[model samples]
Target: MPTLQDVAREAGVSKMTVSNVLNGRRDRVSPATIARVMEVVTRLGYVPNASARSLSARRSNIVALAFPSRDAGGVTPMTNPHDSLFLSEVEAQVTQAGLYLMAHSVNSVESTAHSLRSWNVDGAIFLGTRADEVAALHTAYDAPMVFVDNHGTSPHISNVGIEDRLGGQLAGRRLIEAGHRRIGFVGPRFDEPGVVRERHAGFVQALTEAGLSLRPEHVVHCDAGFDHAVAAARRVLAAPQRPTAVFATADIIAAGLLKGFVRAGCPVPDQMSIIGFDDLEVARHVSPEITTLHQDIPGKARAAVEVLLTQLAHWPAARSERRVLGVSLVERESVAPPPAS
Candidate 1:
């Protein structure tokens, strides 16, 4: 209930000195004075007014973390392991940088722009946003913005993403190295212009180099959800000539496929092999731990936050930057040589 003025009066110091000490501008005041002011502040239980401080600093000290409510494939960002984990990491990094994160699931460019305008956010970090949506938001919002997992080509937009194509190639090569000739691919539509499309392209490249082409029926359209992947698994199982190995674009989908295969009494790696992308926690926890491509979710989160903060610090003078992290293959128990007839 005590105010800053009360603390200043009790400490026998000017309100400006108390303000400097409380705001961590300690260079302006002696250590002894800082200690004394802090002691009085603790004793008085005084709290600074956030609105007043923000107004004086011309910064809200808050950043927005926006992602689509449902991605192009109708997969909820929060439910997807990679997206959720990245969000957690971004929040942690933002907090460590002495800023607050406002995570929002955006449905449209208009709505997102309105929210950002209303909140007066210092900047924004977007995840799983489509290229078109990113372009629209960039034009609509004046604040510094950074995109993650977006394939926008604008020279002025900052972005952080992984080698999605290389990830797909790694997954495909692993299956092929394990002697899987008849293989299937599972993920969002391959035609979409995003991470999934890049990954699928890389997968096709690897297959073509090996003189093998993925059959149309073997390419399953499933989002990053348990039910969708489970249905895809059923379709794969019912095929007259099922693939010996399957590459799932996301770990969540792979986990669901594993569950579906179990329910159908299909033995993994013995009768069928599976490889997944994104070495998420679910990849290891599932039975016959999934072999997957390791994309650094934490690294991506760090880069996104760092880029957005840098833009915020430099404002209009900041040059846009793009960071593309690498990926690696993780061999696990889920993949093996094709079963002998």
Candidate 2:
């Protein structure tokens, strides 16, 4: 294979001129010289040495996608539809920028820091990472980073997320408009300081405005997993006075609740109205489509990549940025007025 030196010799120009042309440093070389160098490169079939370039630049040309994992030693599951879509979009954006993407499962600060350092990644993007873990990772690693769906208040941290509180309010308002008074909320720990907590707070705000309150028994704690949500549905079904409607934090959970209720011989909307967040594809695939709050998954991915790339370009000088996108309601077949008593 022909090398840069060969191309320079064939083009009758110095190696520096060839280097500048190939590296897009156009101002450093004349257009005629650049054209000649390209002709020589095409004739000689010369290919740049990526390793040498990376070594000279002191960069790996690779970024990492740090996925939070429950099992430290196991692979993180991609069953969640929101996670899957977000990953697809991030990969597309990173690849378009000519950078490699490395996905790693992170369960602890020490282990994740070790992995990142070993890989020599230029930067990282964390997905759904907890606030405490993000803080620890920020302190442990000096690399440029961006967090997705994180609620960290640190001025040094950059993040991208949706208007979770507004989404909750929209869901609440939709149900209230449909005449649902006794409503329930199903999601992960609402007391935790994260997206779910913010959503729940907004939901409560809407409820209070309408002179309605979310009952203590109506609040169900279920992780983002489908099976757990199905079990939570059973608990809701068993309540002494069941809620006529429920606001689920995720579409996957809402799908699970739909299944649980259907299996127990309950017709959706007529018996129990459910509204979900994150208008994932699952919302439409279920037997009765779910009404949901639609957030821009692709937009969130693009913003995260853009912020991380900006930080990488500016290094330690780049200021932290937080982007909060809006959400709108998608009306479907899952919400209706309460059943006649």
Candidate 3:
């Protein structure tokens, strides 16, 4: 394999310049120097050492994104679309800054921090992390970190996400506008932190303004997985005071709610109305379609990359800034006025 020394000798630049050029660390070197080093390295066919080059520079030119893994008997269900499309967008954005994307699984705060430090990543971006875990991450690493859910603001860390409270409020308002008063909330319970709490808070605010209470019994909690949500939906609809309308916190749960209603011989919009969050593709394909809150997935991915790259460039101005994106209400045929007695 060709070495950095060979590239430096041919390019008439120092070995350090060759190392920087090969590893995508171009901040210290000018554009002309970077171009010249690259031209010579190409001509010489020098393949530098990734490990050694990373050690010499503080950054590895790699950013890590951590998510919870599906393991064992069951894992919490996800309502948003998988990270594949989101990661693809993030990859395209960061690649322009000469950074490679690496993903890791984080079941807890301890494990996530351990993985980042072990991999020697330049910085990290976290999705679906709880508030407590976000706190632990800050204490664990001095590297640049950005969270998607605004896991609180700080000097060293930054977060980018939409106005979840507004999104939830929109869901509640839509159900009310449909002329349904007896509403039920189907969510993954409020014990776990992050998006659940934000969206629920918004839901509460909207209901309170409409002079309707989200009765404790009407707020059904279920596991995050789809199967669990399906069972929970069945149980809720079986109750004596069957809800005339349901607002599911996730698109998956909303789909489950629809299925449960259908199996129970409940005619949607005629006997029951439903709305879902995160307008995933499944939301539109389901029977009767789903009235949902449309989240900006691509926009979220792009903003996260921009924040991380700016932090990597040592530009502190953008640090600790929270960016909120807007969500739209997608109306479908699933909602209608309450059925006559």
Candidate 4:
């Protein structure tokens, strides 16, 4: 519905300036101006004609937004608002760069390679992939690769991730400062490398620094959605010595936990307090506002695109770097001091 004129006006730049930025003519525009134009483009949801633009560029100018399959059938669902917002920003960048975007949900190395080679892909940004797997994909596709939320280190890969461990520490310290000791952590308590695992590790480290410990029984492992969150919370509720507070590593999970507590008649902040990560839209809309850790999805998305584009423009010599985004705490009505004995 929005046009180039709208984006140009919104970004307070000339039409030519907008065009230069959108067409990947980086030398003609300042970094600050390019960032400004891209932000406005995202805000206005400006989608240009991909076919016409790509032909003019000569390059296929197609970016692959890939992810590992969530289910057994190699289908990854893009159902979360956070993921949607992240993708929305990435789409903005892709459009600004005059590129066509393609999405793929791949489960195996073979399938992933097939998708990359099958399409006229210039670059790829993937979710939930490992460092070694990233290498494998690079070996197969020979395109610029950007990975999100992967904790494992690999020199040849470009990554955009949050300081998940630091976020956990913030949540744990906040709960401890609020006078909660018997804390329950809800999320997938896995030994594998990922955001969830890093957050749990940070939380445990924080507890250890404060002379507290998270007993194995206090850890509830579950998936990242609301249904799994409710079940995970219910497990904590059933524990012999119920925790006074629970910090679900994600806001979506916290939303579920909050609902589970209410459905089970547990008084929020009276019987239990809750904290969540990735301050989602639901955090503020819920009955009692959810206290959460905030991740700058837009900023992260921008950085991820910048990394990929830089690689595309200067590959074989471009630096394979990791960009770590910061996280902050959003205190609201959910957290409270431990209930009286």
TM-score for each model:
0.85, 0.87, 0.85, 0.83
Compare candidates 3 and 4 on TM-score and give the better one: 3
128-212, model 3: which lDDT tens digit per residue? 7766677788888767888987545454458888878888999899888878777888887566566777888898888999999
Clashes of each: 0, 0, 2, 0
Model 1 stretches astray by more than 4 angstroms:
1-47, 70-77
**Rank order by TM-score, top first?**
2, 1, 3, 4
Q: Give the alpha carbon lDDT tens digit for every residue of 127-219 in model 4.
A: 767655766777777778889988776677789999999999999999999998899888865666788889998999989999999977888
Q: What lDDT score is found at residue 52 in candidate 4?
A: 74
| Candidate 1 lDDT, 1-341, residue by residue in tens | 99888998999999888876654344567768877887887678787775777777557778999987866566656877777888999999887655689999998899999999998888999987888787788789898999998886778889999999998888888889889888899998755478999999899888998999999889888878878888889988876688888999998889889888878888897888998988999999988999999999999999999898788767878889999999999888999899887
Clashing pairs in 4: none
In model 1, what is the error at residue 111, expressed in angstroms?
0.8
State the lDDT at 299 in candidate 2. Answer: 92
Clash list (residue pairs), candidate 3: 77-224, 77-225
Model 3: how far residue 305 lies from native, Å = 1.2
lDDT by residue for model 2 over 66-137, one digit each (tens)? 876753213245556777788899999887655789988776789988898887788999997877777798
Which pairs, if any, clash in model 2? none
